[model samples]
Target: MLEQGRLGTRQLTTLTFMMVVGDMMLIYPSVITSYAKQDSWICAFIGVPLGMALMAMILKLCSMHPEKNLVQMARSILGFWPGTFFSCFYLFFFIIGASTHTREVGDFMTTQIFQYTPIRIIILMFVIVIGWGVWHGLETMGRSSELLMPVVIVFIVVLAVCLLPQVDTSNLKPVSDTGVVSISQGILVSIIYPIGEVVPIMMILPYAAKQAHQTRDMLIAAGLGSLILATLVTISLLVLGAFLTQHNIYASFVLSQKISIGSFFERIEAIMASSWMISTYFKAMIYLYAFIVGCAELFKLKQYRMLVLPASILVFGLANLVSPSITFIVITVVPYWVDWDTTLGIILPGCLLLIQWLKSYRKSSVTPNNSQQ
Candidate 1:
């Protein structure tokens, strides 16, 4: 069993918000723009409901066995063999996801900030910081997020305000030229990338403080985070225009580069970069924490921290090996990541909830007959 940790509703909210908004800073606007053109913000708006629906399903599963995390609940509802198998799959999924995140940080730094620095050095430095955070445990991570997320938000709002003078509302004109099919594709990508990926948050839910309502807290956080992302998308579309936004790999970073508040406050991309780094660190730490906790529970280990170092090492190695080029990562995340995340995040958990409901209904019906006898 995973040890119970007391994560307050506020901490959980910040953590969820940070996790969903972090990586979206780097990749989301560009990809969504590619699909929806000037109407990319619409994709983000449409995705919110789908994301909430997925969260509702995972929350239902958690409600069925509030005492157990996703891994343990899987074992309980599916029997040992199948449960272990699925739990291992989740571990692998988190590990790969974490690795990709690590690589993304390295890629961003190497391309935009440290062009001459070795990618491996960037990845190692990032993973080391993340390892330290994971080692400190969930309460520490939660508290850290609670403190840092507000600062990140402040920076984002400041950056947006500073760039307001540069925004061209006409850039967002002629909306939906991409038609319904393309807009739907953008919506799917939006849901998968940040919103639907909240599935992994299920691993942390069981550790929340006793009085906390995990489902309500997560749903609210997810909604708020999605709104923030949609707003950012609208800002990116207005400022960068669809053609520039779609082509740039780091659209937000490029947008930040455009900020020049009367020539005195130029080169504000550093602030945006700092915000991305902090938020991405929180995301990597959360994913790493989940992976370690899941592995410990899978094997019934005494402590999850014991696996942290080896896992970090594994993640570091895989980060380097995952793709030879940043373009490959971007090219694959759309169809590939959407499919992968939808299966694990939505379908599998939804199935578990359905099965658990059926089992409960049958048990209740049988109990009445037995009592009558």
Candidate 2:
């Protein structure tokens, strides 16, 4: 009971990994292929340091106010009205993110594996499981992360091993064919979608165990997770080739399909699919946690658990209504994600850090003189 809402460092690490590797592993192969062609892995490699820097900026901000969530700290620094407005905006972003993720999971499952069944069913089922995780609190979510992450990693390693024979070293030739401009463009897009979008994790930092090394743990988790993602994306490109990887809707899934062992061992897509499902489930749970917490903070509700059901309902409804089809999600939803996530995740948070720096400068300048007086 005492540990109900609290999360240990290892759990937090796993949660961070789960948050990143799921949807990112699913979409990034294709996104990078779209721009960099055979050079797509370059995008991931280029983005990693930039992504780590953005997260470091956020972590520094969190260090400045260790016990406070972004909502509370912003309100304290910006005053009540502006803070409340910012909080509302962030909460809205988190909820819309939940809806978007719900839709994505539904679409992915229905399109790839559950075609005969309605997508609505998939969405509802996902929402229900996610709601349960939300209600149980962040500790349970973190534990789930701990339990599921190893499986995800193992599957990734297995897939990589399987695809080794198929990898065409020629595919990686002339890696700079697109020049710096194209690779840079791919890096920019990849940064915003998967990495910049991690700003929401600031809310969970306060819930992590109160250790002096909390920040260190988080950074390590982020680094290791990014490496895993970068490696997977690189392998996908190498084995599948950029053109085939791009055309394949789920490039990672297709990569698994290519898995072969001698003349007999094959059809490991099911194992890959199961890993994806677990990874995606953890991801949806984190979004659901953010959504529930945001709702509680916004409404000044006493218990976040109470909002879980209504939030799930909201997520389920919007997931279905957000796009006419998966194609629409690709065309419309993704660009909007790239835009809004960049603004909130990168630009706004960076501004907050600047403001805090200025505030510290002004205080230091005046405090010594006032003491002399």
Clash number for each model? 0, 0
In Å, residue 56's CA in model 2 sits off its true spot by 1.0
Q: What digit string (tens of lDDT, one per residue) describes model 1 on residues 143-231? A: 99999998888987887788798889999889778898999888887787777677678888888875656568778888877877888
- Model 1 alpha-carbon drift over 4 Å, by segment: 212-214
lDDT of 2: 0.79
Best by lDDT: 1
Candidate 2 residue lDDT tens string, 63-89: 888877778778877887898898887
Can you list the residue pairs that collide in candidate 1? none
How many residue pairs in model 1 have overlapping backbones? 0
- The TM-score that candidate 1 achieves is 0.96
Kindly give the stretch of ten consecutive residues in candidate 2 with the minimal lDDT sum.
Answer: 1-10
